[model samples]
Every structure is written in structure tokens, then in C-alpha cells.
Target: MPDEMALLVAEVFEAAGVLRRSGEAIAAADGQTQARWQLLSVVSEEPLTVARAARRLGIARQGVQRVANDLVREDLAVFRPNPDHRGSPLLALTPHGRRVLDKITRRATEVHRTLAADIPVDEIIRARALLHRLVERVNRHEGDGRIPPG
Candidate 1:
């Protein structure tokens, strides 16, 4: 069981690396890095504070803050006052940001269409379900100092 788990972990890590590299390439055409693209995508749905965005992205708050700052500097996003939090402002996408994000989404659609052409929809659905289950299991054991040996 442990060996099976080890194998699964290795595969997941490799897959994540591949996805990140591919995502970087996809985002690059829009003049953005993977990190920036992720941040912008998150904020595009709704304005969020840096800490909130970090939590949503499963990353460090400080890192998200830096990216948020950069996006603001680039005129891609804007920081608006948060009514819920006085010190932490909400990050929202600017018009330029929305335009860029739209372009990226269009490109992503094309990429996904090409990639999914040969892949069966049922297999993709099952893969997503399995990943969700894995995430749930990991989250349930978070900070417990140990994971049960499957």
C-alpha cells in the first residue's frame, strides 16, 4: 500500500510539473507568467484581499501580496478599499486585466480543445473526481503530522 501511494505521489508531482510548464507557456502569449495569470484569474471572479487570494490559491500570503503589487504596478489590476477589512484592500481586475484574461481564456480554450480531442470525456471526469478525492483526503489529514498509510 505504501509503495502504491509512493508511486501515486511521484506521478502526481510529475504531472503537476508538466502542467505548470505548459500553463506557463500558455500564459506567456498574453505577456504574463503562470503566477500572475493565476492571481489575475482569481481576482477576476471577485475582488479579494491578498490573504484571501493566497488561501484560495493554496500559496503563501506574502507571495500573493507581491504579485498583487506587481499587477497593480502594471495597471493590470487595482486595489480597492475593502469594507470588511480596513487594512487589507480588495484586489480587482482593471479593464486591461480583463482584456488580457479574456485573451488568455480564449487561448486556453483552444489548447484544451486540442488536448481533449483524443481524450475521452468520461476518463477526464473520472480523473477530476479522483483528484478531488485525493485533495479531500489530504486536507482531512492536514497538520496531523502523519498520513495514514493507504
Candidate 2:
């Protein structure tokens, strides 16, 4: 079982690298990096503090803050005073950011469509479910120490 798990982890890392590269290209179509693209998409649904956005993206808050600052400087997004939290402001996309994000999203959608043309939708859903289960298990006991040898 451990060997199988090790194999799965290897495959997952490889898949992640491939996806990140594709995502970077998609984002570059709108003059953005994948990290900035991710942040913009995350806040598109609703405003969120940088910390919250970082948590959602599973990255460091400091990295998100830097991206948010750059977006603010470029007028792509704006930081609004948070009513819930005085010190931490919420980040929301501006009109221009929305357009950029929309373009990137459309491009990504087309790319994904072409890539998944041969794969069955059911298989994709099953794969996603398995990944989610694995993530959940890892999150639950990630720091509990190494697994015992059988």
C-alpha cells in the first residue's frame, strides 16, 4: 500500500507541474502570471481578505499579499475597507481585472476542452473525487508523523 501511495504521489506531482505550466501560458495571454490569475479568480465571486484568499489557494499569505499589492498598483484590483475586520481590507477585482480574468478564463476553457476531448466526463469526475479524498486524508493527519510500516 505504501508503495502504491508513493507512486500516486509521484504522478500527482508530475500532473501538477504540467497543469501549472499550462495555466501559466493561459494567464500570460492577458499579461498575468498564474498566481495573479488565481488571486483574481478567487476574489471574483466575492471580496476576500488577502489571508483568506491565500488560505483558499493553499499558499503563503505573504505571496498573496505581494500579488494583491501589484494588482492594486496596476488598477486591476482594489482593496476595500472591510467592515468585518478593521485592519484587514477585502480585495475585489476592478472592471479591468474582470475583463482580463474573463479573457484568461475563456482561453483556459478552450484549452481544457481540447485536452479533455478524448477523456470521458465520468472518469474526470472520479479522478477529482479520488484527489479530494486524498487531500482530505492528508489534511487530517499531515503532521501526525510517518505512517507505521506494516
Instruction: Provide the overall lDDT of each model, using Cα atoms, as 2-decimal numbers.
Output: 0.92, 0.94
* lDDT by residue (tens digit), candidate 2, 33-127: 99999999999999999999999999999999999999999998999999999999999999999999999999999999999999999999999
Clash tally, candidates in order: 0, 0
Residue pairs in steric clash, candidate 2? none
Cα lDDT of model 1 by residue, 1-150, tens digit: 379878888999998999889889999998899999999999998999999999999999999999999999999999999999899999999999999989988988898899899999999999999989999878778647477733
> TM-score for every candidate vs. truth?
0.92, 0.93
RMSD of 1: 2.7
Query: Among these predicted structures, which one has the highest TM-score?
Result: 2
Q: With candidate 1 superimposed using the best TM-score fit, by how many Å does residue 127's alpha carbon deviate from the native? A: 0.5
Candidate that would win on lDDT: 2
